[model samples]
Target: MAETALHNTTTSWSSDFKEITKMRLAISVVFSSVAGYFLGATVLDFVDVLLLAIGGYLMVGASNAYNQVIEKDLDALMDRTKNRPLPAKRMSVQMALFIATAFAISGVAVLYYINPKTAMFGALSILLYVLVYTPLKTKTPLAVFVGAFPGAIPFMLGWVAATNEFGIEPGTLFMIQFFWQFPHFWAIGWWLFDDYKKGGFAMLPTGKRDTKTAIQVILYTFWTVLISLVPAFGMTGRLYLTPIAAVIIGLLGVFMMYYAIMLYKKRTPKSAKQLMFASVSYITLLQIIYVLDKFIR
Candidate 1:
């Protein structure tokens, strides 16, 4: 009986750990970092790649765990987050803090083995996400804008990890993801406006989903598409996309824009949901295309 109880306890703890860290979200962010790694790596050190993945996941997980700890009370007020580890009382606050601290320190130390710049950015990502973005969520709509900086770091972080350099190449990657986030997050905010309001979190540009907000989404989506094609024009040194890849990226942008326009026309939650999915698909497909193009050409 004691053995069975131990097994159950272990299983529960594992599940709670995954929940607190947001494993899927952490992995998706790690994927973006790996994509950047593939682009900037000249020699393809498999060991470094492995380290990058581990460090990326740890840092992202730490940030998420910290967010949960800070937002436990607020999270309980929203349906989507009410059942998370902290809000659901699956884990104690002290335990969550321990996990977050362990992950953050380990992640930064591992990244430092890769390079100082990589580790610096990793630390910065945690600090900004937890200290800046989490607190600002209830204060102003500008939270999303402030959040975009740390959110955009993974793309360039992989490049820095692989190259130990920061320049136009990584800058281009940063810009592309930075602009992409506005449309993506705004769509989510549009659909979940009511849920977010329950927590007093103002995530939308206008604090309400209206024509004005939709118009802003459209503008940012357009800019995201435009910046994505800049490498094809030789504007970004050391990061040249073939004209064919450029055309492909342009088409993807157009698809994202179409949904944004649809949201603007309808101004409904359903349309916002569609735009949100499209924005996700757009970024995933864009990263695949960029990485594949780098290898194929």
Candidate 2:
């Protein structure tokens, strides 16, 4: 009986860790970073790629853990966040902080082993997410704007990891992800407007599910689409895309924009949800296209 009880306790802790770290989201972020690494790397090193993946995941996990700790009370107020480890009382704040600190230190150390610049960016992402964006969430609608800085870092971070330099190539990668977050997050905000209000979080640009917010989503989607094509024009240094790849990316952008427009016209929760899914697909496919073009072309 004691052994079984201990086993259950262990399993519970494992689940708590996963919830605090938001494992799936962290993995997705790691995917973007790996894709960026591939884009910037002319010579592939499997060891470096593995290190990048581990370090990137750890850093993202650390950021998420700290965010949960900071927002524990607010998280309990929202339906979407209420089941998280902190809000659910499955883990103590002290334990979460310990995990976060360990992950942050280990992630930065691993990244530093790769290169100093990579570690710097990883540390910066954590700081921005925790210190800046987390606090701003309850204060101003511009929290989304501040959050984008850290959200967009992983993609470019991978490029810096591979190239050990920050240039137009990584800058272009950063810009693409940076602009893409507006539409993606606004779609989430539109659908969850009620839930966010419960937490006193200012997520949407206009802090409401209105035409203005939808219009901003559309505008950002347009800009994201345009910036994505800059590489094809040979303006973004080593990040140039071929004509065919550019056409494909443009179509994907249009596909996402179509959902954005539908959200604007319909002004419904379902439309907002659809836009959110499309935006995710758009960004994931865009990264894939960039990496494939680099290798295949």
Candidate 3:
């Protein structure tokens, strides 16, 4: 009977690993890593691509796992996150800890096989997101700024992976993503203001979602558009943006700004939701344009 119980426990633990890590979300993060890889990879080979995706997924998967482990208690308080495996007790703390460490260590090892620099960056991203940003979320609004470092690195990590060095091309990808996070996150903050408050997360600039916060969102949105165009102006290193691609990317940003302005003016939940969706569409579309522009040019 003891052996039977032990076997059942091991099977249950395996199931919990799948749920606790939130593989779908981690895969989305991995996809962004791939997009970054594409933007920077001058020479594409199947082997390199496979290594990048696997390492990227493992790296991000580890970060997400660590996030849940640390925030398990807080997760129970947030409606949007309360159902996560950790908070729901679907996984024991020790089990989750082991999973997080395994993924993180293995991820770095995989990246190391790509190149030492890329591996370093991958490890740094995991450290920053988990060690720095995760804890800071409950402490201050500046967490967004700190978090952007890791968030932006994926775009450039690909560049470094391909080029084996950091240069203007990867820098441009990093800049656009860095600026983009502000508005993207603020919009979510606006929409989820109540939930964040309930969870004791200080996501918004002012903690209160109102005119002050809205104006900051607008400011960041403007910055995002402006920085995105720097590549087109042909001043940001070798990453030159053709006039046509610049105009198209600009127009997309304008569409996003229009929604942002609307949300600012109305400050309604629905409008915030619209802005959030627009932000998502904006970044994804922008990434598509960046990759597509390479072919067009």
Regions of model 3 farther than 4 Å from truth: 1-19
Best by TM-score: 2
- Encode model 1's per-residue lDDT on 1-297: one tens digit a residue: 999999999999998999999998899899999999988988899899999999999999999999999999999999999988888898899999999999999999999999999999999999999999999999999999999999999988999999999999999999999999999999999999999999999999999888899999999999999999998998887777999999999999999999999999999999999999999899889888988998999
Checking candidate 3 for backbone clashes, the offending pairs are 231-241
In candidate 3, position 202 carries an lDDT of 90
Model 2, 1-297: lDDT tens digits are 999999999999998899899999999999999999999998988898999999999999999999999999999999999999888998889999999999999999999999999999999999999999999999999999999999999899989999999999999999999999999998988888899999999988887888798899999999999999999998888898999999999999889999999999999989999999999999999999999999898
Inter-residue clash pairs, candidate 2: none
RMSD of each: 1.2, 1.0, 3.2
lDDT of 1: 0.94
Off by over 4 Å in 1: 1-8
| Candidate 3 TM-score, true structure as reference | 0.92
What is the C-alpha local distance difference test score of each model? Answer: 0.94, 0.94, 0.85
On the 0 to 100 scale, the lDDT of residue 178 in model 1 is 94
Whichever of 1 and 2 has more TM-score, that candidate is 2
TM-score per candidate, chains pooled:
0.97, 0.98, 0.92
lDDT of 1 at 283: 89
Which should have the higher TM-score, number 2 or number 3? Answer: 2
Please, what are the lDDT tens digits per residue for candidate 3 over residues 1-297?
999999999987766666677777567666666777777767786688788888888888788888989999999999998877788887778878888899889989988988899999999999999999999999999999999899988878877877788877888888888988988888888888889888888988888778998898899999999988888877866566788888988999999999889988999878888998898888888877887887678
